[model samples]
Target: MGEIMGNFRRAINNTSLSRFRFYFQAASFLLLIYGGYLALNLGDQLPTFACIFSEPRGGSCYLFGLQHQMTTPWTSYLSGRGIGLLVGFLTFIAFFIVFNKAWCGFACPLGTIQDWLTALRARFKIRYANYAEPTFQRLKKIKYILLALLILIPMAIGNSFFGLPKLNHDFGVPFCMICPGRTILPLFSGDFSQLALDLSSKSKMILTALGLMVTGIFLSGSFIKKRFFCLFCPMSAFHYIFANAALLRLSKDAGKCSRCGNCYRACDVGIRAIADDLQHKNIVKDDCMLCGKCVEMCPEEGCLQVKFLGLPIYQSTAEGFFKRMQGRNNAK
Candidate 1:
């Protein structure tokens, strides 16, 4: 028991954990640049699946290709607008269960933008207020309300009580109009052409607000900590609902935990996994973006790992089998 306890203590004091956090942050930035480039060049649109839009004849609008086809079918089905919404809901559920918010951390074009802005803000030594506390938690709900409005208002108007077939027609692609990801693509491509007719004054205001929000997030992350915009993203609301059952989880061994709070401080999501009760050893909180920073920062050996399907999937350090065998023999 004494030997086992000593090894556990040694693991907790390990220093490589901090280096891993640096690497994870670097990788996320590289992915953002690549995704942003794809969004800008219109390379994200595949030619084979272009018939799903109202204006299929006008070459291939970036909105027509990805966001419209993917999110709409799901949103429509969820809103009871069509049978396809069921498919969308199921697919989203599957993704949530398997990988949690991996999409937001890695693949989301908008997330990439926010991350880049945060990086820039950090480099320039800017400052913004930290909105990560309980007071700002309610602000996170705005996305869900917006999502509800996006789906509900269209369904109500499309039912024809308002005599608005044109409104219904527009509803098929409404999310694209306000999507920050789609908007940023046009800005990067050096084409203000799409901005002239498509964006309304309200949308322009929203865009302006989003720009300011990005700036604030950047400044906050630079002066405060990384991943500031994650607090208010609607996509995260969806992820929050499904995170509890996610197949991949960050696990911590309580016996090895030294209670130094370094992992909590390193975590941008504010999950204090080390301080939590032992029964729920998994930090399966909705706020966790699965960036693996906590796992990387954990000083305890075998105390922190990324687990999948009830088995350990990733470990920061590797010890030879002979060493493990020797340790086990000595323990006996």
Candidate 2:
């Protein structure tokens, strides 16, 4: 049994992470997109985009619930309604703590779609685009701004703020009003109603137009830039707020790293901290999806790792690195 276990570990360590992730993402994509046919409802507080717009979805995004919860009357906090909000928040935290940002990297239907586009681009021999350092630094903050708006706008709709008039009800769920996921994810399940422009109200018309425009950008941008939408995802920002409390984590052993730049190149979201941060042991940055790509690509033994509850689940190994390289060479 001991020998068998060792061999199994060796096999996993040497396998192609990209190939493994492709199959995993495919399964997750199906489960999230079509699992409702099996009556598999994970719930409405999932950290990832199990879009409600996609009928019979396995789950719903937490943002959808949060935005609505924020619309409750300010005085309701003293009533039983407040308990429901607390329970909902606790539930979201429970879900988020288990997998951490792996929800974004592994299970998000939208993220999987972006990955498929990236693969398609690769197949066509097209070069991918990258943000300039200055631009990346600036753009990454957009998610936080979006997160702030999603929270404050809903509150404003419920009650006046700073002596200002209450926002129009048509601005309901402001973030969702413009989210591209509502426009795109439904198409997988044969629903195209989101494609139409809403003329019922002026606000709806403007929101629908913006939603359509974002959907166009989502499709085109994701094709050219890996995980393009992730840079500005409010959900990503939300996850980062509680990242330190998650059980699953990415950590680095700076002492073991030779800094050959392999891990940085492997990062889909272009997180520079994974490669350059030598001072901190915990390396899961806000933009990191906990995708495990950095660990898989590192050539230095024990340099990078994915840990669950402080125990290493997967880590870089020189032997594994060499074996993977050999396998790639054989394939060619």
Candidate 3:
């Protein structure tokens, strides 16, 4: 078993998995949007933000997006129908633990789109922006705030419907109302209907405008910054709250580390805690999407590793780093 594991780690570390991860992202993007029609043949859709749409979503139980998964199930508390909420919540947990934040890294259509934008910027040789340490630290709090609002607004709105059926038409799923993913992901399917302004009510108009504005910022910001929206993604906050349950993790070898800045520079989210915190061995941070960019870039043998169920699948090595760089230069 030890020999087999050692060989697996060596095989993984020799080649950059991020390059192959793109294949998974592209395939998942296709599957999420069109898999049901394309004969995936699953009885129910795997739960995801985009799968909660009305007619077009592929998921088994289509609620009002991920927000519905968060709210409607809890509504049983106020009303008498707790079963849907309880079942849906369990489904969410089941899908969540399989890979945890790896969803953000590998499968999320929004995150994939942002990565494509980063690639486009790189192709043009345009410099990407990185937040300074202090600014980045402060920005980390935004996701938590968004997470709170997403849950609170839905709970309030779900309850209000029982008490006052005519509350804000757009109140039930407040985060989805303004989530850029709602307006952005459907465009690939040749659906622009989501972009239409909701002028039904004064509340709807406000909600529509807010969603558009956030989408606009998302477009421009993602072009200039890597995973720009992820800095404030409520979904990311949700994942980290249950991160401990994930079997896969990023582990650090403090003694093997050399304080090299390459890992920090390579990180898309600008998480500096990877370098500064030598006190802890398991170095998963809340801001970390578990993308493994640091492990790919680090030039220290076994200094950083991608561990699956407490076993190493990949690790950093100086020789491997230089060999890949040299290969790239020669190809150029």
Rank by TM-score (best first):
2, 3, 1
Model 2 global lDDT (CA atoms, 0 to 1):
0.89
lDDT by residue (1-332, candidate 2, tens digit) is: 99998788777777777788889999988888888999998898899988888887888898988998888779997799899888889999999999999999998888999999998999899999999878999999999999999999889988999999998877768888788889988898899999999999998999899999988999999999999999999999999999999999989999987878899998999998888889999888899888888888899978998889998778888888888778879987
Candidate 3 per-residue lDDT, tens place, 1-332, comes to 99997776677687866877899888877777777666653223243445344224444322244455455535355565465556656676677677767778887777889999999999899999888889998998999998888776666654554565434436777777788877877786678888999998888889989999999999999999999999998778877887888888888989988787788888898988788778988888877877888888888998998888887777888776877677678867
lDDT of 1 by residue, 247-295 (tens): 8877777777667675676566566554454666776565567666565
Cα-based lDDT for every prediction: 0.51, 0.89, 0.76
- In lDDT terms, which candidate is top? 2
TM-score of every prediction relative to native:
0.61, 0.97, 0.89
In candidate 1, position 200 carries an lDDT of 48
In terms of TM-score, the best-performing candidate is 2
The stretch of ten residues in a row with the least summed lDDT in candidate 2 is 9-18
- What C-alpha lDDT, on a 0 to 100 scale, does residue 201 get in candidate 2? 92
Which pairs, if any, clash in model 2? none
